[model samples]
Target chain A: MDLIWDGLRKALELLVGLDPEVLGITLLSLKVSGLATLISVVLGMSAAVAVALNEFPGKRLVIALMNTGMGLPPVVVGLFVTVLLWRNGPLGFLGILYTPAAIILAQAVIATPIIAGLGLAALQHLPPELRLQILSLGATRPQLVWLLLREARLPLLAAVMAGFGGVISEVGASIMVGGNLKGSTRVLTTATVMETSRGNFEVAFALSFLLLILAFSVNALLTHLQQSRRPR
Target chain B: MRAPLLEVLELVVHRDRTPVLDIPSLRVGQGEVLALIGPNGAGKSTLLLTLAALLKPAAGTLAYHGEALDTEARRQAYRRRVTMVFQDPLLFDTTVRENIAAGLRLHGVGAEEREQRVAATAAQFGIGGLLDRSARHLSGGEAQRTALARAFALRPELLLLDEPFSALDPPTRGGLLEDLGRILADTGTSALLATHDQAEASRLANRLAVMKGGRILQEGALQQVMNHPEDPFVAVFVGMETLLQCRVATTTEGLLTLALGGHEIIAVGEAEVGDPILVGIRPEHVTLSLHTDKTSSARNQLAGTVTKVIPWGPFHRVELDCGFDLSTWVTPQSLTELALAPGRPVVAAFKATAVHVVRKGHHGGDAAQT
Candidate 1:
């Protein structure tokens, strides 16, 4: 109990003074996760819409693949992305490993399927009358997709939040590909793990507290958006 | 007369391997309004979808301006010229302004022009105030007006409406129908509507096509079909009353005395003495009285037993088994006045002017069925 109280006092002191190390980790996490989510939203939303609206061969298989990918182990994805881009690996020529871009790419890969799956599910839930109404308006295929996406903004936004939460909280891919280099690639989750491993419990507790605050803020904002869009 | 702006030929559709829509041929002139009438699951909606190019026909030809309508590219091009309004209005998650601007944008109307036209249309449809309101928060009538404004903004050459007024109240429907008629006339935009409402059909359509079992059983001028139906289905569909054959015995002051089934009755229609004529009286036109009054405006009066008093709204339909089934509409007040009870003999009365001579055999082989 004394140790915990001492750690809490240290955390409060660090938070009050805007400690550089703690603040730096939080900012970097935000930057990396924000960029990764933007990329995921663009690619995942497009792919999801194509799968949901258009019929094609192997559609069931494709949906099955996405559903399966939703449960992909974080450690396994870390290993896979790391191996492909590490030194002496297939993409070693660009020497991108240990860079922020590497972490962004890995996190985007981890988050894209989540965003896409939710987007597709949201579109499928639309009523048939709504679909017919758009078609009757003489909307072209692209315009129809845009309309459907606008109509499904809530689920799409939820997907983005889920994807952001998934990527920001994940340490395996960030540690493996980002290398957790001090002052360079050390994000909040990785710094938390590193500090805890080194018996720096106060810093770890602070990072954990920050992660909780971030996640809760995002979730709260998402809930507010969803409720605003809901029918009265 | 201008050539038809919309022509559908042999539109046969299959649903779950069963034939659903089999419209052999239908044509709507440049400014004519055609009504497709049928019961539920009668392929009315399917036919409308096919015409709107939303669904492809299994086997048939669709032509606009004598040119074959084929291919998605061609269909989209034709669809831009021809717009379809569904029973339910689809609005996007965005504002009503965006929903109405969808078609205009596709046609490459500039922002200023689009806004101008959309505002004009919104005012026309009485939805100008709802322009900025999100579609997710609109009432049924508001949504319908927004959908119409969107469709009309395209200035479509042909408009297809599928039960557009089915969800609206009577007053709203009447107002919308009047607006639709005026719009079509002003723009010379032809329309093909599919509905089962008789009053709606009679009010809006210049021509009526009776559909049954995936076929157009009868199609022609609405009044002509109503007055002289070729089939019993068409006759009853158009509100044609039952035909009573009577022998004209005498003519007194424009009233003809007819002998019907060994009972003498007065009819108001002109007929030669000794000539057998048909007397038709709508159920609402006939009255029932218990006393054969000394002075009544009614010229035709006959005593008959109230065989059945079926409650129909504020009025009860009194069915008298007078040789054949003679149905008359009488209010509950009259039902009380005559102390009218089933099996009680009462007088069925009507004025000479109320008797109409519906000529026999106008079209089709449906005279016997009616």
Candidate 2:
């Protein structure tokens, strides 16, 4: 019981005092995940629009693969990304392994499918007649896509939140690719793992608490965006 | 005569290698409202899509103002010239003003002109007060009105409507229908409206095309098509009508006495004495009895033999050979109770108010069908 209370007190103290190292880790975690989420959103929305609007063979199979990727194990993604960025691996020429860039690449791989799957679902949930109606209104092909995306903005925001939430909390990819180097590639999740492994429970508890606050704040903003569009 | 504003030739639309719509030849004149009437799955929506160039017909050519839309550029231009509204309003997640202005913006109309046109169309659709309201918060009728206002804001050369009122309540549908008819007349915008409701087709359509099983069963002017359905399916679908071409023998008050096949019948409609008029009788409006009673105040009562009985859904269409040949709808129970079959004698009666009277064109009357 003292352990839990001690961890809570330590977490509150660190939060109140705003430790520079913990804050740095938090900002870096946010920066890497935020960039990764932004990349995923662009790639995912285009892929989703293409898949949702067009008719082609193997469509169901493609969607199934995307849905499967949405739940892909983070550790598995980390393993493949680690191999891909290894010194002797196929993509070693760029030499970006064991760095924050490597972590971003891994996180983006983990988040793109999550965003794409949800974005696709969000678009398909719209009335099927909407596309035809838009086209019949003299909308060009690009304008039609733009209008449809605007109509699906709410659900797509939820998709972005889900993607960010997914990567921000994942430790496997960050630890494997980032190496959890202090003051360099260390993020909240990886730092928490390292501090706990090193018996620095107070710092670990503070990192976890801060990570929770960050995730909740981001998600709360996104949820507000998703629902504020509803008719009162 | 000027070429039709739009013409479709030998059109065939396929879904997965199976043809769904096969229209041989259809044309719409300038400022003409052609109502495609049919039951569910009748390919009315498919035809409208093909006409709008949204669905590429497997076979056929679409022409606008007598020029074929042969190239991609031409087809795109044709599409831009037309607009369509759907059964669902499909409003965007925004204010009604934005929804109404969306098409205008896409058309590259300037902000000032777009606002002007949007307000004008909003007033036309009676949605002027709802411009700033969120589209998501609108009732079904209001949503549809906003949708229609949005389509008209573009001032489309041709408007395509696919059962826009099918989802509304009857009174709402009636109200929208009345307003839309007035608007169509006021704007003189040519439209191709697809609906299953006969009353809607009658109220808004100058020409009616009855479609069944992906084929046009009949197409003609409203009264001609309704009173003289070429196909029996159309006759039954149009409420099994019997038409009569007659001269107004005398006018007394709001009623008229008509001379028919060596018989005199009283009816009600606007006509000067001796004017030729076409009388439309819905089979359901006529009733039959084994013997006529003097107490009945029915205007026309003629004793005749049952010429035919066609089984149409629950009610059977009973054709009578009353000096002028008429048809009436009778239930199976009444059919059995009255022992009505071909060659059976009975008295057929209809009130003066039950018939529809339209002034005849110079082309004269079409042959009556049973």
For every candidate in turn, the CA RMSD to the true structure comes to 5.6, 8.0
Model 2 chain B scores worst on lDDT over the 10 consecutive residues at B361-370
- lDDT per residue for candidate 1 within A185-209, as digits (tens), equals 9998999899899999877887888
Highest DockQ scorer: 2
CAPRI category for model 1: acceptable
Clashing pairs in 2: none
TM-score of each: 0.80, 0.82
TM-score of 1: 0.80
Q: Candidate 2 — which residues are off by over 4 angstroms?
A: A1-5, A12-18, A228-231, B241-281, B284-346, B349-370
User: Each candidate: what lDDT?
Assistant: 0.80, 0.88
Residue-wise C-alpha lDDT for candidate 2, range B253-367, written one tens digit per residue: 9898887757877897667887766666787778999999788888888899998899988899888898878888888999999999899999998889766664453223332
- The alpha-carbon deviation from the true structure for residue B87 of candidate 2, after best TM-score superposition, in angstroms, is 1.0
